[model samples]
Target: MAHSSNDEFFAKLVELFDYRKGKDHGSIVLTQKRLTYDQPLPEATSDTILPDLHPPQPMPILIRATNAKGKEKRRAKEKVKLSTVVDADNLPAFFERYAEVCKVGMNTLKPRDRRRKGKAKKKKGGAAAVGGP
Candidate 1:
């Protein structure tokens, strides 16, 4: 198949699987014939999708601070190494300070919790009971 055709097919497949449970769209292994458009159109399978070999783990953040002064006669100071896990609640604050200190944006920070919207539903009778006795 032509490159464009392959791209279009991939897009459709992604759209189809985007909301499907237990589906991974990353890292596909296309058959040689499919790539070359040879006879007997190649088939696609979930074989390309591998389970998460390494589960998510929190990594630490490191910060270093230094102060120095003047010519031949000089003074230098260092601060303790600090570490933190990046999370939704704290990420914006972390980045704000990080940018100020490092002068570089660290895009590697992953959200500890996925973005969630809206309030959770209350139990059926819990609200009514709370106002009584």
Candidate 2:
């Protein structure tokens, strides 16, 4: 990309990852041959582990920065494709890992209190601004 931020971009990525942590996954019916007892998505069992859902991440965005020196620094952007580039068989492992992350709780990965403080500040300032000086 045009190389502007490190923390901002990584923070965005972490947020994206957290959102994906509790991914809602649907299971495929392998044996449609009919079962005797009913089979709904099982509740959390002692042995079974349901991992979080995190789709394979896309490649980083590529940016082109024009104007070598001086004030005018216009930038053009190019979006890269979001493809897993992995074999179909190996995809199952990804799902399994996601489930594990879900089991562990996604909140742990969040950036912590700074986000909340920022929101609170914005709300306070926004309210005052909306009301008066």
Candidate 3:
């Protein structure tokens, strides 16, 4: 049995995606693949004030599950959409869940090229950058 309620399911979804910022219009906009910063976003448990993406995928997003539905099943058709918007408060949990669904284990994601955006700083500088120095 699915133990999660509708609200719980949706809440987790929001968390997995991080609220960041979305359009204020009544509908949420779906993005085409935005080349990820090519770096894994900072993890959620950071003691810092804000998190990059709750679930963190090292690669750019090719698709959002909410926007994953389509007539061809594998191809995204224009008329397909599973969700339009998510609540901001639920962002934390949803982003995690989505990462899991996508199999983004801590060390499993492939390293992506980040030089296009003017050279992404790698943390080989150590945890110091994340406040650990």
Candidate 4:
């Protein structure tokens, strides 16, 4: 039963493939389109309709900082996104490779310490520190 379901999903995924184009990275627009492809459109009940697509832009305050330090901070954090549309045809292969890598990564990953490292504890036996007047 699970095998048949997986097959069906694979078939659907293959149907969305574009053979002419290929990519090594993901795209937000493509992801959104793929996600909402089969979904039913909402009824236009209201007069005011909002647009769906909006590109990311840096905050005005961050870009136009009063001090040099603020501008330097923004420059340090800001990164250019070099995105390309991923080939839908290679999706299954890519996912399989990703899964294998993840399995290996999980094996190599070290367990993190959950305890918070706070201020050092004061000496309990020191008479000078706890002495009463």
Candidate 5:
């Protein structure tokens, strides 16, 4: 397999991230599971601390399908994102570098005023023909 360029890699990374725009109003709450209750239950009297466990990270994998003759075709190629186990020790450093790059990109953007001043409307007939008493 050949290595991809940094720009291509970054583009793929962004694509994998797949950030979405949030709703204009109200908040969106995410839940792992849904539960049905007849009435309100008692609140927790104490807090519980859970042990930290490292889980496998999910990474994207490009999958390709071969033709009937066992020939791989470009059109039949598909990207299958499969979960892979990997260490996340460098995640913090990666995030820091990403933030710095993002800051630089943001700085390059110039804020321009979008609102334009209204232009004066011109009269239909100039001076209205002085000859017509």
Candidate 6:
């Protein structure tokens, strides 16, 4: 999961760690000497006070819009535009908008998929028979 901000990522990491440990009663230990700008695998294990491992630091978010032709497009031209950085307070709104845009895009891509099952069955003259008994 790509995070829009370091703070958000950190918060999620803490939450995940706490959940994994089954109890939030330990200090997070960063034994790994190097800290890179990337999101660590959620399953990474750490042998520290906090049994669960910390999520790796995430890099800055990059906002890039693409056109129907698969070419990069300007944010203004795209139907959905995400900000480069978002804090916890605004993250929910950002996600809500993002999900809405994704839903719209998916709907536009396959409108037929939204058809009712009964309507589809009726159009196809009921369920087709499978292999003979």
What's the lDDT for residue 113 in model 1? Answer: 33
TM-score of 4: 0.22
Q: In order, what lDDT does every prediction score?
A: 0.32, 0.36, 0.42, 0.32, 0.32, 0.39
What's the residue-level lDDT of 7 in candidate 4?
Answer: 36
Give residue 12's error in model 2 in angstroms: 9.9
lDDT by residue (4-111, candidate 2, tens digit) is 343343333344445445656311111112111233344555555651122233223221211122233222322211112223444456446535534454444435
Q: Considering lDDT, which of the candidate structures 2 and 4 is the better prediction for this target?
A: 2
Question: In model 6, what lDDT does residue 109 have?
Answer: 39
lDDT of 5 by residue, 1-133 (tens): 4434334544443433332122222211211111112323334434423211211232222221111222253345533221221124544554465455444433324565233232112222323432345
- Which candidate has the top score in TM-score? 6
lDDT string, candidate 4, 1-133, tens digits? 1112323433333332221125333221111123222334444445535322321221111000011223566589532211122245555665585355334433324454233232113334344434744
List the candidate 3 regions with Cα displacement exceeding 4 Å: 1-80, 104-133
lDDT of model 6, residue 81: 21
Runs off by more than 4 Å, candidate 5: 1-87, 108-133
lDDT of 1 by residue, 48-133 (tens): 34323322332223222212223442333221112223333544675565444332222234544332222114444554644667
Candidate with better TM-score, 4 vs 6 = 6
Candidate 5, 26: how far from true, in Å? 27
TM-score of each: 0.20, 0.19, 0.24, 0.22, 0.22, 0.31
Which residue pairs in candidate 5 have backbone atoms (N, alpha carbon, C) closer than 3 angstroms, thus clashing?
Answer: none
Compared with the true structure, the alpha-carbon lDDT of candidate 6 equals 0.39
Relative to the unseen true structure, what is the Cα RMSD of model 5?
17.6
Top model number, lDDT: 3
